[model samples]
Target: MDSGIEIKVMNPRRGDNLVHPVGVGHATSASSAPLSSTSSPLPDERGLRQQQQQEQGLRQGQQRQGLIDFKPLKKWVPWIVPGFVLANIVVFVITMFINDCPKNSVSCVAGFLGRFSFQPLKENPLLGPSSSTLETMGALEVSKVVHRHQAWRLISCIWLHAGVFHILANMLSLVFIGIGLEQEFGFVRIGLVYLIAGFGGSLMSSLFIQTGISVGASGALFGLLGSMLSELITNWTIYANKLAALLTLILIIVINLAMGILPHVDNFAHIGGFLSGFLLGFVFLIRPQFGYVSEKHVPPGYIAASRKPKHKPYQYVLWVISLILLIVGYTVGLVLLLRGVNLNDHCSWCHYMSCIPTSLWSCKSQQAYCESIQYGNQLNLTCISNGKSNIYTLSGERPSQAQQLCSNLCG
Candidate 1:
């Protein structure tokens, strides 16, 4: 059921006809009973041999009917996903600690939380850290990544969450989707997919959305969904309710992607992570072909009539193609990003992918430009957008200080 399929087999015994939930390797027949000691002149070897052949034939038939779960059961405990959840929580706490909104701002939302109080709700509807705090903690900023050579932001941004609500939604999704995947595939594969997909998401977001800072694990979570879809397709023969499963997964993906159209959602990261994870899925989550017997599953002294290939020809073909596409896509995306290529300029309509403007809200990107002058331990910031100015007492200017104050002034 966790695999989104249930396999039922008809019991073949003559007397009591009953249908039962018999998965792969559990098929039974009346003739499968052990031979009596005095009954047969034939050697015990002959009986085992015949039994092996019958079982093999039955399994092969089951394979043709798609009644087998050829892939092995869960060999890994679910720990990596939980670890990811913990890591995100810890990082969010650190971000809030550094934000120190009560000290930094005139007032704070949820001020009762004291040092853990959130930035004003208008500034961050997600109830999270200040944009400057996020930027200092390695949020995704195109200017820093391209000009300052802070490529590490691509990976680090995924661990940073904007607010309590932002982390809450992402962590819940990670727990619901990630734990099951880790249990089925183990940590290494799932972990790589998570991290790489997140980087891919950041890379994509950096290329287009250069105006504001971005942070969240939405991309990584989307990558998990993409992988799930590809895993189902590549291992299509091993599953039941194939059409139903495919439709359900597709519907879920569509709905989630559609949600990205909302403002402030960062759909670019979601799309990028999904594409990356979809290709990576073909490379990492492939399964042995149906009817391909594992040597460990074979009975002793029974030789396989023919050794089937581990994967079907199409699987190998898909694997190669997906790998090539992934490499090429990453290389081109990185090169374009490092070169300061704004994908928005090249594709005017593409911005709609991230946000669609409606009568209720505008999708226009807000650019906060400011002039800053420091004198006698106080920095004065003037927002060019509205000619609004603010002065803050500071010993030294930090990189994101002017930008954060300007964002406030402009707002």
Candidate 2:
């Protein structure tokens, strides 16, 4: 046997001096395990350490993956925000291009959008009248005035604009705030914000508009601004106070607001839109934020009785009344809209400069003064000497030819 294969053996029965051959029974005496090797770890321990490192790497990779997942959320936001911006663009484009002909100019477009309404305003006919077919039918003259009130404008008025520039500015602001809110809160909520805000703005306009026609979506755009301001306020603590941004935004709003006070600018509509948007935003947005994060829950009676399944008596009545009012208003508006009031009809018979326009008369004029003209054997006569005249000459030579020209011209 080799020395490396040597082994030690002990027996209890043999005396101290007695010894046995350790290699007698076994062919190899040395063991495979080394003392140096025993001092160190075994294969299993090394494998476990490698596994722990691998797990740590995996955890780090998962953290990276989480961030990667979050980055893609922006790609999904276009559906909510961009969609509305596109829709507004489409509506305006359609409204503009569809009536580009000379007769259907901007004023004509305004009339079209107004659904041809004429009416006296409810409280102040001089302020702003309602604008809508619905509002037109609902128009009621003051008790003292027997004249039919101008048709109230609402829906179409919101879309109409004082000018192309007015439409452009309002549309631009709407895109900015609308897309922002839509991306953050999603389309459904953004749409609700837009509609409610717009209606609120319209209501404000309704209260203020006297004799001038009110138009444009700025009121609704203002509403969007209010809603966004609300979101910022509600999330200020969580979002790291965006004071600088808010201040800058406010400055921009103020400049535009000042512009509203300028000549031909509708300050009433601007103010109405702003206040309504602010109020509505407070009710729908700021209050909800507080409700969600409040340290202490609102008392049960404040919203509803804690134990009671039904709302409080006052709340129930208030809700009922609100619902009824909305229904009544909608019903009346619908009826008025279908009635198709025409503003031009009322103006057709109105006197202008005391000289009856050519439209009413079959002949030149009811009163007569003769003026003479001779061109290539044709003679023309009119009642007024220096008064304004419209003359047409056709290719002719003789009195018969001239008579034919006058007959045709007069005809």
Compare the candidates by TM-score and give the number of the best one: 1
**Alpha-carbon runs more than 4 Å astray in model 1:** 1-72, 304-306, 369-406
Tell me, by lDDT, which candidate is best.
1
- Model 2 residue 20 CA deviation (Å) reads 33
lDDT of 2: 0.45
TM-score of 1: 0.78
**Over 4 Å off in model 2, which ranges?**
1-76, 79-152, 282-411
lDDT of 1 at 178: 92
Writing each residue's lDDT as its tens digit, candidate 2 over 1-411 gives: 355433332222235322223333544322432222223444545675688799999786666544433333222263644555565555545444432322211123234435232122221122222222212223222210113423344444565543345556766777767766666566766666666556555544443333334556776777677666655554453344488868976887787676664443455456555655554444344312111222233333233112322223443443355446544644653343335433224555422211232454331222224455867534565535445334444343322333322222333
Model 1 lDDT, residue 63, Cα: 69
